[model samples]
Target: MSLGYFSYPMPVNEPVLQYAPGSVEKAALKKTLAELKKKQTEVPMYIGGKAIKTGKKVRMHPPHEIEHTLGFYHEGEEKHVKQAIDAALKARQSWAALPWEDRAHIFLKAADLIATKYRTYMNGTTMLGQSKNAYQAEIDSACEIIDFLRFNVHFLSEIYKQQPISSPGMHNRTEWRPLEGFVLAVTPFNFTAIGGNLPTSAAMCGNVVVWKPAHTQVYSAQMFMRILKEAGLPDGVINLIYVDGPVLGKVCFSHPDFAGVHFTGSTGVFNQMWKTIGENIANYKSYPRIVGETGGKDFVMVHKSADADVVATALARGAFEFQGQKCSAASRAYLPSNIAEEVKARLVAQVQSMKMGTVEDFSNFINAVIDERSFDKISSYIDNAKKDKKAKILVGGNYNKTEGYFIEPTVIETKDPKYVTMCEEIFGPVLTLYVYDADKFEETLALVDGTSSYALTGSIIAQDRDAVILATEKLRYAAGNFYINDKPTGAVVGQQPFGGARASGTNDKAGSMLNLFRWLSARTVKETFNPPTGYHYPFLKES
Candidate 1:
């Protein structure tokens, strides 16, 4: 029995070119995604009603632990970004003027169309570009997008029909409408669902969006835009561009028509965007809105009364799903001293048994990290943990790059709760375990809040009714989705709106009506038929 952890190359199902310099499949994939041909062409930056090819390009690699080039994305320049912004500004007037039902219909049709024709491409792209397993890619890239688009339409309609009160001898009504300008949306590469979220939320509210998608998954974003357009979304209503952060921020911040920004990324980037918005505050034509969902170092707190089997399953999913790359991914666990040994045994057993292989294989529970950069980061963390005298590798922690960026599911047991590994966001298939005495349950909860910087997603496994209630109430701020005897990941749409608090996010919780309100501005429209030919004048005189 090897306790050192296992690593494997991502096996390919079809013929894939060796990640060589100029292979035919490599060229073909790039061409298919980027070049605009007589039939299907490679993708480009959608700006000002046309696809603009860039002088520079970004290369993408297959995530299946296979040696092949995914494709290249057009590295859009400042001009393209500005053009996209201009187009969005121009489109907003007509889009905002459309009746609410018409606006809702566009999103509904777009959602159904994607589920029909484009799901395969979206899922396959995530599997290749994001290094996610088949199930993860399908869930994040295809199903979640469909959920947001469909659910938001219903939510928007309900909000649209809401009306305000009227007073005696007077008529008054209030309505919520789109902001009178364009919205700038910046998305992360971790989930295809986010691509739909940041832009679709505003677009559904009749605000045209100038969207800058993650360069890594630009192909998936392009496919989404095409589907929306085909479903009768007017051109320019949802413009897509690709450019680096600083340059794009300048356009988003300085433009008078840039009414708001919807963002999802790191805390550092969010801070920078917030500062830029501030600097331009005096020059802006309107008070701009900036909404963000940032980083997380999420935690899972467990007690001795918990079911060991349930804890094992929850730990496996929370720490290893998507190779632990999600912002809401749980990176640390706190266990009671009495059951620490039992919990560790079950966790190790489940982690060691997980298959590290291809997405299409269906049985492999884990897959490669998103890229070599992430692989190196996770690998460094494992090495550091090994060097720490207080910590020892319990199950798996190894890396192999025979094909793509692959790392084994890793669990490290730490004696000292104050260790840095227990505090930081490992953002990989790496989990740090800390044990405490059963009598110190409240102490353990405090330790969880102190060590973990995020309150994104977490869980507790306990059978005692009072204990469950106590843990849930105490750790309410520990996560956006706090589960009892269940995995923290795999939050279902419509049932649990997902997002976090504190350093995690704005707690808007995607997939619900609450998030829709963030994208709209309230308007009060009052009409008096000339005071009913001067009838209202009597009330005014009496007052």
Candidate 2:
């Protein structure tokens, strides 16, 4: 069944709700959190409409308050992974044959469900599972995910409407077809929006998906799966699983039915997957599409003439929000010696004023890093910097994980521009700075531009138009999502379609038509009218 050449509504980004104290949204969120606290749910690996129990459970704990158990989820083995792939392939025929309008409606309705009924539920789950505060959860789990769903459906219609013009005697058109086999979506723990978008984007274009969500993110992912099912997503359309990375990689790469992979994670993992796919290239039905966004050693450069206050606030918000877990988070900074003290003073105040604790306390600006492994890794970087002669602890290098994996927002200043912390990606709330002579702005720009292999996002703060133009021109390739005076984080859908090149994976800008195009393989169809019975062409006639 199909709707009659339906035109979709104009897409608008969902506004992020500020969950301030005493507001209705805040009150609703609190009530939902309380209700969730009373319930201990068992999340199971889902396959072909059945919840399969694997006998091993991974307990879910709030990263901010690690001792408190929110719930636990079953862990899957090879059997379950193969089962998910089998189910998706089995459903591929009917699912792919369904009308595009039918597939579009399911996701469009899911967008509304996330916006209205499932708002508080997803928010509560993201806060507990990811340690995001109320406002953070609102922006990520609810607002951004809703935008991804609505905008993707809108873009699908736009793709289908694109047709080729033909001459008077002939008619020509193109049909966009989904991949012949399954697409695997491997999502990250940082953004709940990413977890949902990666899989649904492929499936919305009429492909089957076997999604393996990060174990740490599975709690909220389970909630998202429930939302899709409620929104009328058919069984076997998207199969959710929980398994070790190597185990899944072995099975997925070797299968002749592997068609594509939509991934967002570490750079190392993406490269390894690429190698495996290349080795098994001869086994696949088609050359699979590989789309990924990986680790970023993102940066911010502040000119001497820039506003110190604006620079300070940008550093505070950009580097520390969501505990510096965003792929675009500004991790390294270059400040001129002229504004060094003023910018440093203002940034210190911002960090000191921030409250750090559990998400239950809405007032807390900082929460724990994702888990203990991350906590230890970030601390090691700080500890190494503290002992190094070239670096000095500027402010906030404290860490305590007695009850939770908590680390204070840290800032390290270095005389050596090549300090370890300045180049490596810590993936936590650690920002490093290198002050340069005001006269050497060009040199400093070069340093900042070349310091990292990853080029996901970066920003320049300047009032000087010439300086701004210079920075913008020189550092153009340094970041995919470049900023003028604003910070590097907080890229909205539609406006700033996000992704990066170089070591940051393929720069397939998500949340846009370019990303939707990746899932479809187009075929051109041509027909001739008033055909002559003779096969000879007019060009063959002898003059």
Candidate 3:
């Protein structure tokens, strides 16, 4: 069927647009945003490449400007979940049997489409629907999504080329096959790129997927689905549905054809899904691949020799960007007492200077949180810290939800290392700081490691080489994505394959070959050039 070996070269990461004032990209993005805001879009469930609309519609609103209407999405019931699974299984055979190069091209074309035709649309939808600013939207909805698609294709290609060695007179080869059944991709609301990557990455490996995105992210999700369709993705290859998580899980987890799940959400939800799968283990066709990147109370550790300005800048950006909704966002920090006062002053001044408002204004660095529920949850911690004597508010603890879910970038100075705000994952623009003795750098490293159960992302900021080395060795298992004198966010696709362990995720490394390996099942074949027809050996006859 195939003639020659095909090689897909490694792809470079997409360049992030600056969206500076008077720039063409900024103008285009602004125009797209205006167009998106002017009309109300009617979205539907994509089942088997057909738009299935139930009358049960949920209103979509911008988190920053909740007073205005964006659009509505038709919500589905439990039966639709069943339909999605059936549709995925029906299309699995043809999709898996298609040539790997064909699959690669489909995603590659999708990447190009995002990079060219639909770049502003992608960023615009994310900016409005998710309350992300122009720059944040560009890096996430445009660049990161494009990077994931291209990098994943290249990574999967490399995976296909890996084979086994052979002995004399024989040959050996390996066939990398997709799983027997369909994959379930459960994506989150925080990152538009994650929403795109989870489903496409699995589907790129020749696996059919039943994708369910966060309700808040459906706007951008639908945009991405349309792009995939235009890129020539086959019917039922990836079925996008809108249903409650429990209802969807009820059907898929118990089904015999449920092969795996590509998930990015909370740890509690992941644990529940794993437990349910374990309960129904005998009902499935294979051991389900439960891959997830869940919650994080990510940290930053500063040494005495670290620059105060550098420490301040890292905390300012790493803790507050995207309203601190990123799982990799630095939520906790341990600073030495030597330069802690100076860092605090600079950080406070920076936080005070940030302008908070809607994403329409390019000048505003801070925007609303995702929703009312997230606002309440994050505000409660700040409120609790206010009442406790052990914790003191450093700056920015105000919150209001009359028009939109807006919370100030709050910082709490805590005497206890394991303070509630430090231990718990408050996924908002809130950072907790704890000062340690300047001489106790190693002890402080241990404190940072032992403070939280999460090991998602963390950084050690130090100018002293010995302090860096000691902290690196001491906090080896503290984080999956560790940084030296840098913030623990903004992981590039090809350079830093992202994921974590210790309740963070399976650490399959999404941007690398390791993730593609999860979707594949390998079979080895060995053949001999000659066969022996004699019943006995020459030595036996002589004896």
Which rank order by lDDT, best down to worst? 3, 2, 1
lDDT (10s digit) by residue, model 2, range 1-543: 765898886598898888776788888898998888888889998898788887799899888888888888999998888999999998888898998888888998998998999899999999989989888898899999999989888888999999999999999999999998899999999999999999999999889999999988998999999989989988998999999999999999999999999999999999999999999999999999999999898889999899999999999999999999999998999999999999999999899999999888899999989999999999999899888999988789999999898889988899988888888889999999889999999998889888889999999999999999999998998999999899998888888999999899799988888999999999999999988897998899898
Q: List model 3 lDDT by residue over 142-177, tens digit each.
A: 989999999888888888888999999999999999
lDDT of 1 by residue, 344-442 (tens): 899999998999876645567888887677788889989988888999999897888887678999998898997877877777888888888888887
> What is the Å distance of residue 418 in model 3 from its true position?
1.0
Global CA lDDT of candidate 3, please? 0.93
> Least lDDT summed over 10 consecutive residues: which range in candidate 3?
534-543
The models' CA-based lDDT, in order, is 0.77, 0.92, 0.93
Report the C-alpha displacement of residue 8, candidate 1, in angstroms. 48
Off by over 4 Å in 3: 534-543
Model 2, position 145, has a per-residue lDDT of 94
C-alpha lDDT (0 to 100) for residue 309 of candidate 1: 77
Residue 427 local lDDT, model 1: 79
Candidate 1 stretches with Cα past 4 Å from truth are: 1-41, 530-543
For candidate 3, give the lDDT of residue 479.
88
Task: Estimate the lDDT of model 2.
Answer: 0.92
